[model samples]
Structures are given as C-alpha cells and as structure tokens.
Target: MRLLFSADGSSGDLIPMVLMAREFKQAGYDVCVCGSTEFEGMAVDFDVPYEAYPHSYSDIYLDNQKTGYIHNIRENIRHRERLFKGEFELLSKIAPDYDVLFNFLGEILVPSFAEAFNMANVKLFTFPVIPSERYGPPMGLPFVTENKWVNRLEWAAAVFSAKYLFSYNKTIDRMRGELGLAPSRNLLAENAQCDHMMIGLYEELVPPCPSWSSIDYSYIGPCIPSQPAELSDSLEQFLSQGSAPVYIGFGSMRHQNSDMLTRTLVEAARSAGVRTVLAQAGSTIGAEVEGSDDVYVLREYPIPHHKLFPRCLAAVHHGSWITTHLAARAGVPQLVLPQASDQYMWGEIIYKKELGPKWVDMNNLSQRKLRTALERLVAREAFTRHASEFAERVAGIDGAKNAVESFERVKSKLRR
Candidate 1:
C-alpha cells in the first residue's frame, strides 16, 4: 500500500519519522515523507522520497517566536487558520495517492485532513498527547500531579479548556465546508478516526498501556537509527582533555537571548567545577568568544548524539523527545531546560526516574541555580546508575520494527 509519512517539527522530531519511513520502504510499502522544505535534505540523506507542505515550518516557528512564543493563544490560532486553508487545498489533490497517512506529529489539524480526504490515518506520537488518567497531557500547566486521580481531573479540565481556548473547531468545520463536506460532528470522534497509533516513547519511561482511545495503541520505544559515524578526531581530542564535559545544547529550540544562555551555561559549569561542551544548536553558546579550557564550544554541526553523549558527564538540553532518549540511551544524566510543549513532561520523567535534578526553567535560570543542578547531577551516584540501567534496557528495543508490524496489522484490517 502507498503510505505518506507526514512529518513536522525539529531534528528531534523528524529524524525518528525518517527512520520509520526507511523501515516502511524496507517492508516493501511505497512510502514517501511529506513536510517542510527546510527538512528536504534530511530525507534526501536517508534516500527517502519527500513532499513539501503548503507552508514552511520556519515561517511558523518565526511567527510563534515573534507573536509571544506559545503564550499568545489567539495568534497561534490565527496562524493555523491561515495555513490550514492552504494545507487543505494541497492535501485534497495529493492525499488520494496514498493508502494511509502516517502522521509523525503533524499539526493539530491532522484529523481534519483525514476526515476531509477520507485518508486512513495513523498517528505516530513521539510523546503522549491523548487524554488519559494514566498520565497528564503534555502541554501547558499542571500536566502531572500527585496521583492518577489528580491527573485524570487535570486532563478533563485541560482538554475541555483547551477546546474553547483555541476555538479551532470553527476552523475545522470551515475547512471541511470549503471542501464541500459536512461540518465535523464531534471533534473527539474525528480524532478517534485513526485506525492505529504508535507512541514512540520508551516503555520504561511511562506506565503500561491502557486503552484510553478507541483505536489500539502501541507503546513502541523511541525509534533511533544507527549512528552515521564515530565522533570527529578534534572532538576526540577535546574529550581526552582532562574530564568529561556536560554536553549542553537545546537541539533546535530557538534561544532568543543566546548570549545570556551561553554565559549562564559556561559560568554554571565553571562554578560547578565541571568541564562543559556546548553543542551550540542555533545558540552561539561557545563560539569563539572567550571559552576557557573547561569550556569546549564544538565547531561541528549535527554532532552524533550516540558518539558524544557516552563521553559526557551529563546531557543538558531543552528536554526534546529525541534528545531525552539519546541522553538516556547513552547512560548520561539530564538537566532539562524546558521551554515549551512536552518538554516539561520529559523533564518530570528525568527527575522522577532519578536520572537528573529537577528541571530549571529557562526564564528563571541563573548561574547559581544551574551550578546547583549540575553539582547534584555529578555528586549523586544514583543518577549515573539509573541512567546506565535505562540505557541497558533501551538497547534491546527496536521501535521502528515494532511500528512496521503494527502498520502491517492496520493494512490487513484495511484490506478486510
């Protein structure tokens, strides 16, 4: 069957989908990934066919950063309103070419696209989004709580409040109407249209599966592709220069005050008496600007996490899904600086798992606070032991293959 792996988000998000696309092709399905022009080269690198979305992800990200950065709910909805109009027009023409639309964390309007185009939908969640009493929804405020009951209450409130807060139901209905279809009967039902969902998160990180949604859920571990190569020679030399440095970088998350962030990381590492290696993803943390021997600012872009993390004392990052998994798989403790979305959830996981200290908010981050967090990460032996144990378990999971097997079942049901 023809499959369209629709992907969005940063390197943390897209890389796993690309790995799955490769797997689907290997399984002998006619598969192609569709998303931003910004990520076309990534698909090319993996030898997978790619399709461009109606609007670029950079434009959306820039707009979010400009218009109050995830706090401005009105602007967020307005931007989605503008783009989904054009997205509907594009998907209408191309969707029929595919038997199934396997969404790799596409925007919220994915269900609308599935409904309007009559596409077989399969949502591949890198992190949990569906409402559940088991865990809190990974978004703004009060995501996790003291117990499952509190989590359940939080979910009910958050989901209900979010629907009215965003007010995108009209946009959904409007998009459907424009396509000469009836308005959505129930938004939740629309979401439930998917034949299957494969959650690409480590099973150890979360509790066992509960059938919260009508469709079956597959708790596949994070799908990590094989590393491209070993670390470059200069990086090798740097790792050998005394002690293991804290690998710090916020993967692809934008840092508005990169200078301030940079200063904080270096100063904190120095205060904690540990060396630091700044990966510097879009943040000019350690880029030729007075970095000492204790602070090594990597000049290389896209350094393999697999190669570098094992050598680092701790992985400090924005708690992106992929970054969290990589850090865990490498047996390194984490210090998550959560900025938005499911990042906070991952941070909570790291803290709860004893893999790291409690996450420090970027807005409130200071040299003193970061130093304390880093010191805790280094001084505590449990964090290292827990991380190593998690890695040992993670090494056995093949989420990409599991996801393909689930899809095969979906295909069989479609045939039936």
Candidate 2:
C-alpha cells in the first residue's frame, strides 16, 4: 500500500507526522510526505519521499511575531493562496499512486483533496483545541460553570473566528471550486467534521470530556522519536559537568526578544542555584549566549530531549506538545512560558497538574518573576515526584505503533 502524509505547520507538526510516516514505511508501505520546505531535511533524515509546499510556514510564524494577530491572519491567507496554487497540482500528481492521505490539524483543503482522490483521510492532532462543549474554549478559558450553553458559546466564538474573522470560509470555498468540488459551508465547524476518523496524539494527557464522546476520534498518546545519532561533545560535556541543569528550550517558538529572554533564563537559573542548558530550538538566542559559568546554550541541530532532559532538574519551555510531554516522560518539573495558539492551554494543563509554574505571559515576563518561579519550582518536592510518576505511566504506551494499527483498521474497514 502507498500512503501520503500531508502535515502543515512548523517542526512540531512536521516531525511527528514524519515519525508516523516512518512507521508506515517500516511496515513495508510506500510513503511520501507533503509539508513545508523547511522540514525537507527531516524527511531526508527519515529516508522518505518528500513533496514541498510552495512557501515555508515559517513566514507565517515570523510574520505573526512582527505583526499582530489580524495582520497574521491576512498573511496566513496569502500564504494559503500561494500554497493552494501549487498544492492542488502536487496532490493531483500523487493521487493516482497513493491509497490514503493522513493529515495533521485542520487543513482547510483536506475535503477537496479527499474528493479529488476518492481516498480515505485521517486527521491527527496533539492538542484538544477543537471546538467542543466539553471544554470552555480552545485557548483554555476559565470554566465559570457546568452550564452547557456557556460552553457552546465558547465554541461558537472559535467557529466564528475561523469562518468569519479569519475569512477561512471564503478561501476554502474558492479552493473547493478550483478542485471542481462542491462548495462547503461546513468547512469550519465546532467539531471534527471528517467522515472517516480523527485521532489525538496524546492519550488522556488532557483527556477528552464527555461532550467529545460522539466525535469519531482516538487518543493514541505521543510519538517519541529515537535518540539522535549522538550529542555534540560540548553539549555532552556540559551535561556531565552540571548538577542536573534546568532544561530551557522553546521548540519552534520564534521569540521577538530573544536576547532579553535568553538573558532572563540565564540569570533566573543562576539565581535559583541551578545550571541550565538552553536548547535554541529554531530560536535566534544562540548569539546572545555568554557570561555563563553555570549555563550552556545549544544552538545545534537535533538536541535529543530523551537523552538530555533525563539529566535536568526542571524544564522551561513554550508548553508545546512535544516538549511538555517529553519533560513529563522524563519526570522533570516544568516552567511554561506560553506565547499564543494552543500553548496557553498547555501551560494551564501543566499548572493544573501541579507539574509547572503558572503560564507566564511572554509580554510581561521579567527576570525577577522568572527567578522567583524557578526558585519555588525547584524547592517543591511534590512537583518532581508527580512528574516521575507521570513518566512511569507514559512509558507503557506505544503511541506511534498504536496510531499505525488504528490506521490499518480504519483502512481495512474503508476498503471493505
């Protein structure tokens, strides 16, 4: 069987999809990945066929940092247009040979692709941000009550943003028209609208609520990749020297004030009497690393979290799915500085679980505040113990393998 893995977004999105693609390939199925050109190297690393989308999604991410959300949405639309111009053609080119298309998040164009190929599509995601009556809203709103109407309105706001505010409906209609598919008003809805199946990358990390029971979805935990070929000698040496340094890395989060943030992290770690190894995961903070007898910043490619995080006393990151879960799996307490998107929600999850500090707003973060939080986090024995127990629980689940098995079952049913 031939499979197409079409994942759109940054490294966080692309890497997991690539790992799942690797699983398919190892299962002796032919596989190809469709994603941003930024992830081409990752695809090559996994020895899979890759088809690049027109422009890098990094443009959208960097633009969001420079501009505001409204401007970011406009730029996203522009990028999507650029993407669809060539994306459809590429899908058409590959449609004949590939039997299935697996997607990450809600690609507005998935329905059109499914229509064109007459193939089954599976939707996989990490966060439970999809509009649901189960949770208040996607961005982790405070629950005022158990009133279902209140929950429904929260979800309505999300749908309104996609369909009206972001103007996704107009663009989606145009793309469907271009593909000769019927217009779709239900393109941006409050639930997983896929006809086939949807899967969550986490297994009850933020377990789905009762309201989401009707949705055709599965919770398959996370796909932890294999350890890197080897850590750099410098990074390895630093890990050996430090007294279980605090792990600081914001995976794929482009900070507007990298210098300030980097300095804050370094000083905060020192003030708390802990060393740090900052993983400059696609951040520009590498050049700002200095004056650090107690700190080492990694600007290199492939800082293996599985290996390095096990050596850290605590973790500080952007509350992305990969980093948060990895830290939990490593049994290290965390400090989450959330910027935007589902990150805010993930930070809250960490806080609620008592495994991390409260979500520190990026706009208002100061050295003093960070130092205090770190000091408190390190002083707490409960955080580390809870994190360790969570790690033990996570170790038993094989998420990537389960996802492939789920896909096989769905494909078999669809074929029949």
Superposed model 1: Cα runs more than 4 Å off? 62-79, 185-189, 209-213, 287-291
- The alpha-carbon lDDT assigned to residue 266 of candidate 2 equals 82
Clashes of 2: 2
| Count of steric clashes across candidates, in order | 0, 2
Candidate 1: tens digits of C-alpha lDDT, residues 1-416: 78877665556667777889988899898888877667888889888998777676657763354212356334444566655655666677787777778775435665556656667778887756666557676653324553777777766765575467556667877777877778765454355457777888887787653545466667777887664777877677878877988888876666566677788888788888998888876555565555467877776766688888988998999888888988998999999988766677888889999999999876467888899998998889999999998898778687888888877766666521
lDDT of 2 by residue, 1-416 (tens): 78888877777777777888888889888899998878899989888889987667777454455213444335545565556656676776776677777776546575467666676667776745455554454442222233568778867776666677665567777777877777676544522555454454455467666765666677677876754667788877877775878888877767666787778878777889988887887777656676365888788776788888888899988778888888888889988876655666777778888887676766568888889988978899999998888888777666677778877666765531
* lDDT, model 1: 0.73
TM-score of each: 0.91, 0.91
Q: Deviation in angstroms for 268 in model 2?
A: 2.0
Report the CA-based lDDT of candidate 2 relative to the real structure.
0.71
